[model samples]
Target: MPKPEPTELSRPYWDALREGHLVFQRCSCGNAWLPARRHCPHCLKPEPRWERSSGKATLVSWVVYHTAYHPAFESRLPYNVALVQLAEGPRLLTNIVDANEALVADAPVELQIEWEGDTALARFRLAHVTV
Candidate 1:
């Protein structure tokens, strides 16, 4: 399915996805931003530096969806959608691989970049956990 276009506020996020990195804006004023804002909410500074994320995250919650909100998603029904807590302290909403569902709840997952057309979005997969 064709991916949707990103707005100006979300361009950096899509760009970072294409580069195979999870980049978030961090201000020297001790602020970490999410949702790709134009400036730090606390200090109100523009052009914050892009920080490379560790790609490490833990699943916070998930639901096994059986419904499709769009026709493009009908084939992907029964998939698991989840919210993950990034190691960097941001919460990311993403999809979890089905093969890893047994380990999903509270399980660690790593960020993966998938390009659909010119746009790229970040996804997640099971993180190899060692006993």
Candidate 2:
């Protein structure tokens, strides 16, 4: 598996995931985001505060990759890559841990951290669904 190369700015995000907490950067302008940056993208402010998530999210959209885009992912072919929006307002690309057939539009999801070597990945699973 290709591992994440955490930059100085993103180290804290990785560390928090490792410690079992999912966090996001919130600026004074009230914008929160992920894959951290030195300045807030909204107000261009420096040093936004970090806040822990409630581990709650909403499934926005997703697609199943029947073909591997990278060699390392061949074993995991036909996986669903989803766009999920956190309750606090940040959206991230992640995987949904549920049967592809069970996925539904706007389903509620909760955090599910998975480990890759020493890196903790922030994935999610369905909270409940009917369809």
lDDT of 1 by residue, 45-86 (tens): 897777889999898998887888778889977777789888
Candidate of highest TM-score? 2
Off by over 4 Å in 2: 129-131
- Give the TM-score (vs. native) of candidate 2: 0.95
User: For all candidates, what are the clash counts?
Assistant: 0, 0
Q: For candidate 2, give the lDDT.
A: 0.92
Clashing pairs in 1: none
User: What are the TM-scores, per candidate, against the unseen true structure?
Assistant: 0.83, 0.95
Candidate 1 achieves a global lDDT of 0.79
User: For each candidate, C-alpha RMSD in Å?
Assistant: 2.2, 1.8
- Per-candidate local distance difference test: 0.79, 0.92
